[model samples]
Every structure is written in C-alpha cells, then in structure tokens.
Target: MPYAKLTITVPDAVWIGELSRAYPETRFRVLAATADVATGVARIEITGEEPEAISEDIRDYDTVTDLTVFESDERMRRVQVETTVPLLMTSLQNSGVPLEMPFEVCDGEMAFEATIPQQNLSKFGETLDGMGISYRVDRIQQDVESDPLLTDRQEWLLDEAIERGYYDTPRRTTLVDLADELDIAKSTCSEILHRAEERVLKDYMGDEKGARPTVAVSSD
Candidate 1:
C-alpha cells in the first residue's frame, strides 16, 4: 500500500461525510482543520494509505486534486492556550479580591506595567490562589509583536482614522469615504488594503510551501 496526504480546503459542513466515504477501509488521521464562520473557509488536512484502488489496479486516485505528497521532514505542530480575558476575569471575581486596584493582562509571554503600587502584587497573587492562574507585575518592559499587516505609515493611518472616528463599531463610513477623506483614490485604497492583508499573513504565518501529494500504482 502507498500513502498520501490530502490538504483539503473545503466547506466544513460536508467534510466529515466526504472523508468517511473517501477512505472507508483506510486508516487515516486529521492533522489539522480550521473552520471560520465569518469567512466560511475550512482548511482540513488528512493523511492515509490507499486501502482500495480507484483506477485499473494502478494509481490510488484517478484525479490529481485528491492527492498531495509531502516530504518526510515536513510537519505541522504548535502549542496554544485557549482562554478569553472575560472568562479569566469571571474566574478571578469568583475567587475573591483583597483590594480595589486596576490592572491589565498586558497580553504577552512576560512582563507588565503597573499604575498601581507594587504592594498590590502579593494581594493579587493571593486572589489568584484557587483560580489556578499565575501572574505578576514586572518593572522591565520586553519586546512584543505588533500586527503583521501594519507598516509604520499604514499603522499611523489606521490609528489616525480610528481617532477621527472613521471605522466606528456603528459603521461610520465606507472604504471609499475614507479614501476620499485621505485624498487617495478608491483603487489605491483597495490596493493598500489587499497588500497590507497579504503582508500580515505572510509575515506572521510564514510562506507555507505547497506539498505535492504522491500517487502509486501496484499489482500483486
């Protein structure tokens, strides 16, 4: 038997059914999958061998789209924590606070800035007791990442626009309206938006080289 990996970008609603039928007797693994309701983009990865043949006792699949080969060294893996600030806050409140001090999560691996006095740290640490969370206030500021999309000029523009009430939650103005306000053409504005989006993904996600799947024909 020969193996292949299929990186299928399709609708999540139909993926499970298709997968079951496609590899009925074959042992397979779902390496990764992402379903975003907002974008309706579902990225799925599955790897398995051909337990049954689809051609004249030859190649595993008759169509090329059904196969994607990968080198042995290629891999995908990561570690992540899933929790929101609101949930964390609710958990915190459920624990108990010894004082009335304002603080922020700072949203990074290490370090934080404190407007409140340093004494508040121990009190907060005590509050974190039953919550199973660890936190601290540090005097040093560390390096962190900004959005991958924003250039200095682009970030400056977004900040200024937000400050000027351009893209409010209530939808103040359209992109064309903002373009006119910035004295740039609509097409130029669209181009900037496209470039900025692509740059952010490329910079942050890294350029993922496409894997070409393998096909094998075998006969006893």
Candidate 2:
C-alpha cells in the first residue's frame, strides 16, 4: 500500500474549475461525491464572503442540471449538485481508486489525497495523462502497512515538540520543558521522542538496512 498526495490543475472548461478561477479567494471542498458513466453528484462546501452569489452562478451552468443549497450563511454554503461527470472523477472510477473525500479546490487547482495499491498507482497516473489533466505528485509513501506510521501518543508528542521549537536551530525548548508541559517524566519524553524520530526518519529515507544516523537530544 502507498499513500499519495496530488495537486491537479482542473481544466478551466469544467464548471467547478471555472467557478474556482472566477472566485480565486473562495474555497470549494467536495465533502462527498459519487458518479456513474454519464452523471455525477457532489456535496460541496463553498466558503468565502459571497457564497450566495457563487451558488447562484453555479446554477447558471448548462452542465449542472440541478443545484440545491442545503445550508447557507454569509461565510459558507453547502450544496448538492447533479452534473455531467468531470474527467478526474471518471478516471478514478474507471481505475478503481478510492478517493479520500473532503478534498479541496481553490483557484482551479485541486488537492487530492489517497491510499492506493502500489500496482494501480502507475495506471492512475497514465489515465490522468491520457485525459490531458495537468497534475503534480506532491508526495508518495511507499509500502505503508495497514497500521499508521506513528502511534497516537507519538504523534501528539511529536507535534508538541515541533510547535515548541525543539527541533529549531538554537532550540527554543528543551526535553525537560516539553516533558513538564505534557506532565511526563524527562527520561520518558526523551525515549518517546527518540523512537518517534527514528521511525519517521527511517520511513522517509526508505532505509531498510536501518543504517540511518541518530539525532542527539539535549537533556537540558
């Protein structure tokens, strides 16, 4: 299994792409979407200053057959729309790749993330290329297991450490301060951080031989 993050530049001819380009400041999050061969439906959350105006504009598009605004306010509007299937969605459907929902589109670019089978990754890329879709693969994590890379506790501690500048040059926070803030002992914090760092670095380097260098932690 592998995890991939892609940034796709939606063609301006597509309704959603055109709308996003028209309102560059607005964010369109496709919370849920489903499509067949000819038709597709998506529940999208439009967030910006003028969601009402945006919604109205969407209804004017000929491809969009129906648009229902389920929720609306000054800052956000949630709508479900029935429309002709976009090329990206069609490709995903045909390739049998499960798209992680709640993906975003802003200024005609879509941020897509998915966990895909290693074998299907190349096929997916080829399909996108065949459709003339412009895209960039931002990241790919290969051979990821069913379990997550980091444990919950490790993730929480790592986040705290980074936020506190433990990894910063001329580090702003020490192991003692970090442990104290989390109500854990200094030695325990050090051990947990070391384990977390090792796991992350090893995964990043793809160093199966485990010859990666160790990071020194200040006990102070």
Candidate 3:
C-alpha cells in the first residue's frame, strides 16, 4: 500500500507553534496527542528540554486552557496540555489518515507519518483544505510491508536511546550513558543503535525495485 509521511507547519493557535515561539531553544517532541471531541479539548504529551521552563512558558498561552505534569526527568518531560485550539492531530484524524506514533514539534512544525491509501491522497488533501489548515507532504511512497525492518528488541533500544537524547546534535547522552541506564554493556548498546539505524535507513530508502516517488507538497 502507498503511504505518505507529512511534516505539517501548524498555525499559531496550536501547541506546536505556540510553544516553539515561546521557547525556541528547547526541542519539543509530542509522544502522544488526542483531541477529545466531546470535551472540545486536545490532550497532548509534550516532551522537551526543560520541564519547569516549559511549564512556566505554557501559562502564558490562553489557548492551553488546562495543564498537568505526569512525569519529568533532567533530559525531557511527559506533560499533558489541554488546549482549546483545533490541533493538527485532530485535523489528521478528521482527514481519516492512519497516523504513526511519536510525532515531534520543533521550530513551529509538527512531523507525522501515515499509511494512507493511494486513492485517498486527494481526499486527505481535501480534508485539510476543508479544515483551513496548511501542511506539507515530506514524503509519499509505496511501503514495503513484506520486508520487516527492526526487531522488537532493537526498536526498544532505539526508542530508549532517542528518549535519552543519544541522537541530539551535540550528543546529550553517550552510548556509555545509555548502556548505564539500561544496565547493559556499552558495546551492546552501540551495536543495537547502529543496527537499528541501518534498518531504519533501509526501510526509508526501500528496495530498488520497490522505490516510489517522493514529492514535496506544500500549501505555500
């Protein structure tokens, strides 16, 4: 089936644009986001550089009508922000796209990947247009489901490493640090990360015969 990965630049009304404007230096990753239609509120888990700083910054936005901090660590946080604005997540759902998890928010943009039907691509576009939302199609291609990418254990290691900031530009954490956290050998951690990265690249690129077109779609 054909799939598309979208990197959408949301409006200032949403949390991504709002928090990015407030705290440009810190990175923000949305671990989970759900729009409760009945309540007319979006409950989101925003993970970012300083929990306390973000908490203080959030108070400035009237759009975020409610806030709750579920957990925090030195590197990142998992807090719930209830907002009144119509969210990009909601927009995607309204479009009927099957979104992938662990989307991110940074520099006023939200990145999401979804497996959408080839015929429904236009439907998705029309849905976004109807919602009056602007977005960009980062990648759209035919997915190779037959080929398995990473093993469950490798995926776990990669997810953990990412959460620990091992992939940060300056390298917030090291392989040694990750190993210590997981109580495993440094060599083991390195092996898993390397292998996982390889699989991710392979999957992203796809096989030569199965490679599909990649177009940059933007409302601008």
**Model 1 C-alpha lDDT versus the unseen true structure:** 0.39
lDDT of 1 by residue, 135-211 (tens): 43333233354555577766666665576666678877778887898898888777776676577667665544344
Q: Give the count of colliding residue pairs in each prediction.
A: 3, 0, 0
Please write out the lDDT profile of model 3 over residues 49-154, one tens digit for every residue: 6767777677667666777777777756666777675556667777677666667677787777777677677787887888777888888888877755778989
Model 3 stretches with alpha carbons more than 4 Å out: 38-49, 147-220
Which candidate leads the pack in TM-score?
Answer: 2
TM-score of each model, in listed order = 0.24, 0.67, 0.59
Ranking by TM-score: 2, 3, 1
- Once fitted onto the true fold, the runs of candidate 2 whose alpha carbons sit more than 4 angstroms away are 146-220
**lDDT tens digits, residue span 9-81, model 2:** 9987779999999999999999999888888899999999799999999999888999999999899999998
What's the C-alpha lDDT at position 153 in model 1?
65
RMSD of every prediction: 23.5, 7.8, 12.7
lDDT of each: 0.39, 0.89, 0.73
Ranking by lDDT: 2, 3, 1
State in Å the error of residue 10, model 2.
0.8
Worst 10 residues of 2 by lDDT: 206-215
